[model samples]
Target: MKMISIGQLAKRTGASVRALRHYEQSGLLDAIRQDNGYRLFDESAVQFVERIRVLLRNGFTLDEIRPVASMLAPQPPDLRTVCADVIALYHDKLDELDQRIAALMEIRASAGARLAFLEEQRRRGGP
Candidate 1:
């Protein structure tokens, strides 16, 4: 495998250097530190970065994508036919989203009731 510098990876993926650094920090990508004090990566990192971009575009957070990040290797598979791990991750994300939605619904209901009470008070000329 050809080892490429971080600049090459950033250029190939059109991801900013800062974002690549963030990926490394987030444990979503890996690199090797050269003696010259530069980070290097295998050429396959292009695929990984692309996959990360696509997932982010589709609302997959870095944490959510971490489990399957390395599975893509040099190429990403068709997501419609995902592996068991990916399927489980999807289900987990869905469940998390459902819980968030339920919580938001409750908050919305409370806010709406408060708004209605304030409107009634205003209508009655209450200070």
Candidate 2:
């Protein structure tokens, strides 16, 4: 089995050492320490880190990402159950995003209306 030191893992994965440490602290990634107390990561951890990056980029909070992140580990989940859970999570996130978008659109409309009113007042020579 090929093993990489934490620094090499960080360099290859474009992740900061601190970030990796955080992941380790969060139980998202595991590192074995050498006799010298330096951390070593398995090669497979690189792929796991990449998966974490994907989950986080897709707007998953750390808490939300943690469960999904655990899935990337070697432990196996029942495929159908896992798929259903993921679908549910996606639906929930979609609803939240929809609500946020609606609120933003409402704010934009209000801003536009205010702008129009100001423009009209300016044209009428109102201070």
Candidate 3:
């Protein structure tokens, strides 16, 4: 069993040291303290951190990933059920993103309209 130091793990995973510490603090990654008080991680941590990074890149919050992270633990309950729950979470996130896009579109349209009106007024010599 090869144990990697926190700095090595961060380098291998392309995550900043601060981010790795944040992940540990957020309960996303687990690390062990060496006798010398240095943080060490198992090789398995690389995969876990990669998964976390993927989720975050895809707009999943740490809160949203918590359940999924738990499911990835050594002994998880009912994988099928976990998959279903994760799918439901994705659906909810998708719905929220859709609503946000709709609102942004509305704002964009309003801004465009205002811009056009202002341009027309300027063309007509109005302040």
Candidate 4:
């Protein structure tokens, strides 16, 4: 099997070495430790790294991307191969985001109200 150094992988994939290391740390990618302590990776690592980048770009967090990232390793997912677990995950994420949005909207409204009250007090020269 063909293998390459992390630097080569990063260069070929247009990812920084730091980013590659981050991916490894996040468990989104893997590499082999050589005797000299250099990290090496299979040719397919390019595909996995690219998949991770695409998933992350689409707003999937590292934890959320793990399973989906491996679904079609070395290849991209296809609609035909879509499964229930992945679908459920998307639904869960959407639900989570909705809850967060509602909370943030409430905070925003509260802040706006306080700002308006302070501005009014300033205008009226009230203590």
Candidate 5:
């Protein structure tokens, strides 16, 4: 029945206290209340916060995360559906990254070509 305050949680989780508060506001985390109006979180909350960090890093939108997090509630499992959704999301993000990379490569090539042409023009005397 051990619990920790917000500062302690932040120290343990390596997340800012502001971020923890935001997570609570986002319904991604919950805290118990002490009689003095202090917020207390169980040790398990550390793991939950880490999971949230992982999801965010993986490009999971907050809204999309809601449905996935629903699986972690005190209920029956829905892992298969969550896995499928995560796979699709990953594919979409990867495709977006690929397109971005291609655009950057094209821009770089164009810049290189322009520089080469300018160098050649300069070599031919200012024209």
Candidate 6:
């Protein structure tokens, strides 16, 4: 079990050093400090960071990821309840996305109508 420095972890995880530090600060990761004051991470950090990245890409905010991260920790308790809660969160996110898509669609239709109306006026020489 070779412990690696933060830089190596960042390279392996494709996450910036600053982001790694931020994750540590956010309690999403843990690092061991050497006597020389260098931060070392376990190899398992690679997968943990990947999970974090996936969650972020999937629209989960850092704050929202905290609990999910906890659920993935070693020796997690019964996950049935957690799964239910996560399902609810996902549903809420889906609802919000639906609303946003509808609003954008409405805006697109209005803009298209305005453009068509302007084109008709131009064709009619009505300014």
TM-score of each: 0.78, 0.82, 0.87, 0.78, 0.71, 0.80
Q: How well is each residue in 1-127 modelled by candidate 6, as lDDT tens digits?
A: 7788999999987899999999999999999988998999887788788878877887888888787686554332454345665677678778988999999999999999999999999999998
| Candidate 3 lDDT score relative to the true structure | 0.85
Which residue pairs of candidate 2 clash?
Answer: none
lDDT of each: 0.86, 0.82, 0.85, 0.83, 0.78, 0.83
Clashing pairs in 1: none
Task: List candidate 3 stretches off by more than 4 Å.
Answer: 73-82
Residue clash pairs of candidate 4: none
RMSD of 2: 2.9
Candidate number that wins on lDDT, 4 or 5: 4
Q: Residue by residue across 17-93, what tens digits does model 4's lDDT show?
A: 99999888888788899899889999999877887777667667888877776663654444447667777877988
Across residues 1-127, which tens digit of lDDT does each residue of candidate 5 receive? 7799999999987889998888888888899988998889987788778777777887666666766664443323553345676666668778978998999999999999999999999999977
Kindly list the per-residue Cα lDDT of model 1 for residues 1-127, writing each as its tens digit.
7999999999999999999999999998899998998999988898889988987876789988987986756643454455688778778878888999999999999999999999999999996
lDDT, residue 117, candidate 4: 99
Worst 10 residues of 1 by lDDT: 73-82
Instruction: Give one digit per residue, the lDDT tens place, for model 2 in 1-127.
Output: 7889888989988899999999899988899988999998888899889877776777767677776665665443455235565666678888988999999999999999999999999999998
| For model 3, the run of ten residues with the poorest summed lDDT | 73-82
* Candidate 5 accuracy as TM-score: 0.71
Clash tally for model 5: 0
Global fold similarity of model 4 (TM-score): 0.78
Name the better of 1 and 6 by TM-score: 6
lDDT, candidate 1, residue 72? 53
